[model samples]
Target: MSYLKFDKDLMINLEYSLYRNILRTNRKGAYQNTSISGCNTSKYQGLLVMPVPFLDDDNHLILSSIDETVIQHGAQFNLGIHKYNDDNYSPKGHKYIREYNIDSVPKTIYRVGGVILSKEIMFSSKENRLMIRYKLMDAHSPTTMRFKPCMAFRNISQLTRQNDQVDRSYREVENGISTSMYYGYPEFFMQFNKRVDFMYQPYWNQGVEYIQDMQNGDTFKEDLYVPGYFEMPIAKGEEVIFSAGDILVNTSALTDEFNAELKKRTPRSSFYNCLKNSAHQFYYIPKTDEMYLLAGYPWFKVRARDQFVSLPGCTLSVGRPDDFTKIMDSAIPHIQDFLNDKPRKNIIKQIDDPDVLLWVTWALQQYWKENKPVFKEKYVDFLFSIIDFILSNKHPNLTVDPENGLVSTYGRDVAVSWMNAVQNGKPVTPRSGYLVEFNALWHNALKFAEEVAAATNKEVLATTYEEKALKAQQSFIETFLNDAGYLYDYVDGTYADRNVRPNMIFAVSMDYSPLDRRQKKLVIDFVTKELLTPVGIRSLSPKGYNYRPRYAGTSEEKEYAYFNGCAFPWLIGAYIEAYLKVFSMSGLSLADRVMIELEDQMQNDCIGTLSEFYDSSPPFYAHGGYSFAMSVSETLRAKRLIRSFG
Candidate 1:
């Protein structure tokens, strides 16, 4: 009865099947991703991609993939596919695939000769462990299953080459073998529930080309070090569970542990539940004592803006106050960095984004609205500190314009807000001064902070923030509105970006909307006429001069097209909020249609989860990161909003 399944017709069609992928996460920052047919089509695709604590705290593909073959009556059927150099797919294991289903776990059934085998893949919730259960449903005779374990032991973002430094030797444990290619890498342990004999033959799987990487202008071909195969006798009705982890484990208890972890999962009956379940995949508790979110699967790390933007939907909407509190508490320090504009390393330096602070305040406001706290002294002080930082305008790159009370990027070369798509060290969309969404969130933050301050009995702070918010509102309404009925996307000196974009939707979507009912209707109508798409709202309306309909080609080309016209599924949530705000419950029909459109996308790139973006043109092909946290979380939020209206 599961709707998420692919039959042999589609499974055997590489043109269609190769584009479709599957992802499994451990909720602790580790994940497994590959093509639906178990082919490694992308460098980010792997059987075991986990964060290695000892090796600089980045996700590494310790195990690239494992291929399974069935030996019955001396005939072998390889149920594994790999793309070699020059775009050659060896063994062509997908040809034997009968069915593939992604319900709870990714299950693939293969029919070879008279033997039918089913493989189910699952990951442990709290640990870096992956379990693959193989069941022989129907077979004419006993079958010998051989598994070849391919180990990369390199960063997921990088590729590996065949080298003599790789250690071929492996230590045999109680019911498994532990292997590591080099020093500083976590030793990977592969074990099985049933007794099996491991062959000592080791070889290099060279020229394994990740097609998607080549298309992205990255190192596509990699050399995988695969130690010998494990041969086990499996009869009809017999099941075998294969487990892999960073540390040694008791093989016998893996099944029971996996089952117990399964018991902890919420039931996924609807598309909303599916998205809600995937939202948990992004939740990570690293060395930081508080919970954080990884932006996306198989690649991205924790980002300040992404975490804050996704927090309310991923946690608060699910009625998880404890998770919300942990996430907010952990994120406060990062938001402070944005306010302070303190220098940091690579990605953290991006905290200077004016929108990060806005998102943080908005998240806190949403949290406070849901559960009115009795003024926790520490949290209240934190709120006051944020207000002080924003009003002081001490940051080097960001400043609050005293005249307008609007926040803007101080430097000329800086891309402060989320429309940040940089190429060759220059912003694709140079939205430097007073971005539409930034000022909208800015107004909302100040208003929310004023309320917070008043609730905490700090009357002076409340009055100051109230005055500042009103000033910003006055300037925003006077300066940003255009004759076209939509607010300008950004205003930097005399150059005002008068593009139709989803950024203006936040003006009316937030709780303390700065726009009046009439203006809200104008903005909503403008967006609906131009920016709205089936998947989400486009970054720039096609009617604009700068709109890019497609997101494709080289890294530089894609980066240029990133925010220029790419459609973000997360923005759909704001569009829904704006629709409901402008038309009240009467807008439920349109909002429901938007939500349903996004729901259909759960079956696309990453099954049961939404992608980060899509093309702005017809069909709106999903692109960017697969299993994006914001996409999943915001979809859940939009669904909740529509249901509430109903």
Candidate 2:
């Protein structure tokens, strides 16, 4: 039996299948994303999407979608669905879907008149390629499969229209044709494993709309270029593979290559396996084989803070320490460039986020705990340099307080920390000056650096970090602890914003904290009552200011509500850590209860992955990135922690 499958009753219902989408990544920044019923519902949906680094850092949708038609007795049935204006779907091909399953990769079975067809989708891990294998399961007569590809050679974040700039020509490749709609992009190829016929009919299919983007007040209509169709015959029980990618392929090897890549996939049989599969998708290497972890799917790029925060769980917790070394091997240099005031490098644009260096410190701490030999060999000196740079007040945005030893940043003008949602050129939640998590991370980094230095026999450095850590501990208690028992979210001069945000939970969750055991317990209790939800940790409590619980409104309104009330699944790991630290064996029941509730979310919104943010109130509608890197990473880490308790 499959772990996640929707039957014909569910698949034929457009209401059910349209809201749920599936994403498949090539592990190299390219992806194939669309709804489960083979309909493109968002601007980000595509079959062959790749990053053209020469043009920009964003991904371009080379192939928006492929429309397949099953033909028998010269009668054609289009097994494809596309949304247009006024909630109308042309051809309404979803009615033919028999079942949809992702037990391995995505396999959708469609039944036409007397014809049962199955299509399996897979991605090439090392290359920018997507493959779809179609098998005529049970056919009453000779069947011909027709493929009509919709091309959108534009950035996935933007919409394309009927324009004259498109190159409306094609050249024959191995068993298919190669064409590019725009200049400065690679020639996208469509090939088949067997002999096929290509018909040349170029036209723009306009007014194709995306429902999600439309509701979000974004430009949802696009015109896709259709370069004719392909015709191929198949016998009953015969399988053929269709390959699409930026790179040209040998047509004869399509079937074998698809099977070979399919063998590399880790089956989504269990919760851990599904998360493990999702974790592998965030590894994006766009240029020069330089590895980086993309923050999330469809939209987010490689970010310094997210790279570090998500690296340990996505790679280390999933037991891929070598990938951890590989990605950090490329990232450490870029991070150093930012710290040294050098020009920006190729990827990882957000190195200047206020807490990026602090996150790197924590990430290395995780590495050291996992594998000391590699950590020392690759990152020990680098760690020492990062701590030394921060201690010396060299970072552009961060400075260490000489009196208190806590880290501080100026964020009244521009938001500097991870709560970086902005509206109208101003920060929605400008958490500046002695941020709670920033200081928590500072204290933890000092303690961790002291341990590393002392173990490495650096007595002077160890003593320096230890003394500063002590000063920071005392000042943290005096400055952030409020009359309500929980720590203030941030403090600026005489102003202390005691918003019951999740930032305070990190102080209790970290390995080294200034708060004593009693204070930590108090924090956990307060947070559990005020902020904790089944989905994850609420960014701010309902009793706090700007308390908008629903993640609905105009685009700007949504941005304003962001970081004010949206509950983030990425906080599950830290929340669990704080809970387990305070309650230990006794906390397992409630802790596991929260986690199990989140586990069911794997089947919601997106299959095998968690969304970026969920509504804080009941029904917890997922609202942000469909497949968030931190969400999968932290969930994997929490699951591993749960096993350790047993």
Q: Quick one: best lDDT, which candidate?
A: 2
* Per-residue lDDT over 1-646 for candidate 2, one digit per residue giving the tens place of the 0 to 100 score: 8888889998888877888889899767888888898888789888888889778878899998899998888898998888887888987788988889998799999889889999999888878888899999999888888999999889888889998888998999888999988889888889999889999999999899998888778888989999899998899999999988888998888888888888888998888899999999998776565778999988888878888889988998899998888898888888888778899775787788879999999988988998887777778899989998998899888999998899999998898887889888889998789999999999999999999988888999999999999999999999999888999999998899978899998899899989999999989988899888888889999998698888887877789888988899889889888888888889889878987899888777888899999999988989878999999999888877777888
Pairs in steric clash, model 1: none
Compose the digit string of candidate 1's lDDT tens values, residues 64-172: 8899999988888888889987668998999999999877778899999898899988888777888899999999987899999988988887888999998888999
In model 2, the runs with Cα more than 4 Å from the true position are 287-289
Report backbone clashes per prediction: 0, 0
**What is the alpha-carbon lDDT of model 2 when measured against the actual structure?**
0.88
**Candidate 1, backbone clash total:** 0
What lDDT does candidate 2 reach at residue 581? 83
